[model samples]
Target: MKNMRDKNSTNSGFTCANCGRTVSPAAKTARNHCPFCLWSLHVDSVVPGDRAADCRGKMEPVALFQKRDEWTVIHRCEKCGKELPNKCAPDDSFEALLNLTALQQ
Candidate 1:
């Protein structure tokens, strides 16, 4: 059986470590971060949901960026100083996205 941490991964919903929100997985895709606070964990190495990384760092939402007309959130690992870009979910908080985008403007 998978352990508690393994069970509560991107495939399943889990409480957010940054905002303490009860985040649910995306309906049709893997939930990479908390929709409420836009925070993520440093679990994936080369691809999203791969779970091959062992950094276990707290990913902080830093900014909003666009690629091919799609908006993505920039996450920075607090422990390792690595930066990654994640697409915004359908149910992600619009206010949070606006705030991050505004900062860049």
Candidate 2:
């Protein structure tokens, strides 16, 4: 049910809107969202690290998780029907996780 890209990232470098940071696709660039903040630019396919889709949808973190020896966050785009799991950075929003849990209940 996940629309994943089979190719590597083709686009690199952008001014991050969340925290005024610059990002570029790199071999070890495992970050999909801003490390300074949880907000992310509209990029990538359903899965992070792949840039094979043309949706150009703004991804917003709706849920957070650090489960089963893994760290992941759930993203949903308002412009598109794409939803997928992305890797969460250590600087991710703890408040966002709380908000998600509160909304779930």
How does each model score on TM-score? 0.87, 0.62
lDDT of 1 by residue, 5-96 (tens): 58346578777889988876689878889999899989888778777778979999898888887889989999999888888888999998
Count clashing residue pairs per candidate.
0, 0
Cα lDDT tens digits, model 2, 1-105, are: 022232443434455565676654444546676554455645666556666567766677677777888777777776785777877655556776667667657
CA shift of 96, model 2, Å:
4.3
Which residue pairs overlap in candidate 1's backbone? none
Top TM-score prediction, candidate number: 1
What is the Cα-based TM-score of model 1?
A: 0.87
Runs of candidate 2 with Cα error greater than 4 angstroms are 1-13, 18-29, 95-100
Off by over 4 Å in 1: 1-4, 7-9
- Error at 32, model 2, angstroms: 0.9
